[model samples]
Target: MNKRFYIIFTVILVIYFILKYLSGFYIDFEWFRQNNGLSVFWVLFMTKFNVQAMFGTIFIVLFLLNFLMIRILGGKGRFFAENFLDRINIPAIGSSRKLLLLIVTAVVIFTGFVMGGGASAFWKEYLMFKNSVPFTGFPADPVFGRDPGFYVFSLPFYKFLYGWFMSTLVIITIFTVLLHVLNGAIQKTVRGVDLSPFSRAHISIMLAMMVILYGLSYQLAAYELLFSQIGKFYGAGYTAVNANLLAYRAAEVISFIAGALLIFNVFKRSFKLPVIVMLTLIPVYFILGVIYPALQQRFIVVPNELGKETPYIQNNINFTRLAYGIDRVEEIPFANKRELTYADILKNRETLESVRLWDWRPLKQTYKQLQELKQYYYFNDVDVDRYVINGKKIAVNLSARELTIENLGVNSQTWQNQHLIYTHGYGLVMSRVDRITSEGLPVLIIKDIPPV
Candidate 1:
């Protein structure tokens, strides 16, 4: 609305564009190739435009809506705004100089604590990922070994923290502003009334409860799913697991009830029943919901698992085989003997011919050169697997993964592009390893799934 504000905004836009160009240039530089960690910071900084745009849009819409609402409400709204601003200024808090100093001090202290904690956690995990000895697990590709090309070359952990920090700060700030607006609106509507729907204490408690609920939601959801899956497979020693799951669910239900009661009390200004319930539930939750289950699992479940190892082993084998599609293979049991026969070789020719010897690293490069349809469609890695085709076992090379729109280019990663236009990647590109087309491309065996 002012010339100074416009000047500052324009300067920020120019600086951001300059930095964006620099980041892209640096990514292609040989220096960046040698020092990948430096690129992480620049990439994270350049990629923050979308998040900034989102929060900026939210702030602008809220400001406009507040202005329109006040205009509709007439003189009362103007008077309320004036009174609110007046009350916000602390009485006899000394001169403007002192007030500015105090504000600066408070900001420094607050940011120091917040940023210190974030940096500590970030560096701890960064070092862990950086110095980690690669091992076989969910995140590791078994065929290619532990270190996937993506994990080895990219600073995913740093990028994740950067995104999390930016999004959390933006969301929290937006919600805080919205909450302030709502409080002011309520106060304006109930002019001169003693009873308010939301007191400062009530808002503070609710905010704290929200953070707790966010953490509990993830914890409870993960454990609930784990126990449910375990119950489906291992029915023998699942009673303790079931009891532990029930305890967790019960705790979650009680926590939700407590939060609801707190909200209800905020509006009704009721007696301290909600406070009493919350206080009581905390201990009850600790005892019945946490301790009891742990004790039961330790005493009953451990002994039972030890005694009945065969069933548990069978369940594990069944689940693992099913998960990896090992059970789908045609199994033909044969007697072991000191023998070397052409008959055995003939019988197992299908399996022998399906053995993959082509290195994936070079194959990935070849696929990128020949198969990539567009800039967005990336061929990151090659996977080799044997499949029964027309009653014959054949090995196939494919890359099922595709880069997200955000990874395609910054310009193509608008809100609609990310959230709507292309929410997920296209399907796999597959071909027989030993075959080539006339144009020197891998023989197209199975193209994109869903036909497009």
Candidate 2:
């Protein structure tokens, strides 16, 4: 019987591990390499909501409860062990079921390591991404803060076992192993206690009930809601992964509570006071920890492009800050869609140009704004800076070198200075550059401008 259980556990673990490595596990690392930082929430969700989430959650909780129950009852003078077994006159587990469970769990975990593609392309990519410098999209800091008491709740045990990623796979794998041990112990305890068929049935039904509740709490309900929320908001890409880390922390709390509750339910006869207190206090603590962050105000970056000198809001908007009045979200424009093209190409490149070199900027300029004037204004021949239409060769005087409607008018696109832009069609070549050649503005028609 023990050997059969071991085989079943091993098969399940191996299948899951292989799935983990194949499902783009290393993309997280690739993201960190390109983006310059890791978002733990993102990776957790992707791994958790997989098919394994369903089976793994339920099995682990019941398995652990079985172990603790055996340990408490197996001891001399334990209430349930003394009361129930005394009345039934049945043999409790003569041998340790916990040990059998441990063996099965070990086999399953070993399979996970072996079948999960022993460090292939995914591993390599993850390593590269982690080693590279992190990328920051915004010009400011963007990592979310963690709760201080998180480590307090997750202290010496769970942390020591998993070593940090705190993923569902690791959680499931760990709890599953523990469950096997407890399940074996409980079976042994029943045999030693000498319970009847009816009692056995009663126990089995109760165990099943606990399993279902724990499953819903640990795997299905808590973590799924959080991860699903993240996926819906963040989009299914590496850039939007930070949301998953928050969900993982929430899931961890659920696991801890479910484990506690299972033990309390099994040993309802003795230690009832302590169990009740733990049940009440622990849940309240976890609930507060989860809610505090959501209540506090957070900084969010909102980006858009519109007409303005600088569109970035330069203040923090928090709960207290809101009382004084402030925009909830700040907007910053990354780029402008405005286009800049040359004005005139007709009477040499120097003769054709726009009224201003760069007019896309909101700054307005007039002819009087020129501090210095020059008859012959030269531009960066290699890099076209500015152009002159009627100015002659002379030194710049002053007045910031401005211009007016009298000195310059819109040039004709089809002027004589325009190049013959040819188009070969039906044995005819059309001049495509004529409009743009003389006057820089392609939109201007030859008839619109007065003849020079």
Highest lDDT against the true fold, candidate: 1
Give the TM-scores of the predictions, in the order they appear: 0.38, 0.26
**For candidate 2, lDDT tens digit of each residue in 1-452?**
45666578779977887788657657756767578555653554343443233334333444445445444543432223233223332123223444444554564445333323222213333333334442222222122222322222322223222222233344443544344233332233644533322223324334334433433333322222322322113211111223233444554465455445544544453333334543664565455444432332122211211111021111122322443444355777889776555443344553332232323221112221221133222111111122232463311111111222222234533443233421111111111122333434322111111211
Off by over 4 Å in 1: 1-84, 87-197, 200-240, 270-285, 307-313, 329-452
- Model 1, position 304, has a per-residue lDDT of 75
User: Each prediction's Cα RMSD?
Assistant: 21.7, 19.0
lDDT of 1 by residue, 1-452 (tens): 54466468768976996798678766656465677666665554444443344434443453344334333442332223433433454345544434544543444344434444344444434545656654344334321223443344334454545454444444444444443443353343543432123333344344435534633553334333332333335332344345555666677666676766666665565435555765777687778556886677676666775553455456557656765878889979897876868998899876666655446787788767755666777876788887787887789988864764645577776888777777666777777766656766666666654533
Against the reference, the lDDT scores of all candidates come to 0.54, 0.34
Clashing pairs in 1: none
Show where candidate 2 strays beyond 4 Å. Answer: 1-106, 114-184, 187-290, 293-452
Q: What shift in Å separates residue 186 of candidate 2 from its native position after superposition?
A: 2.5
User: How high a TM-score does candidate 1 get?
Assistant: 0.38
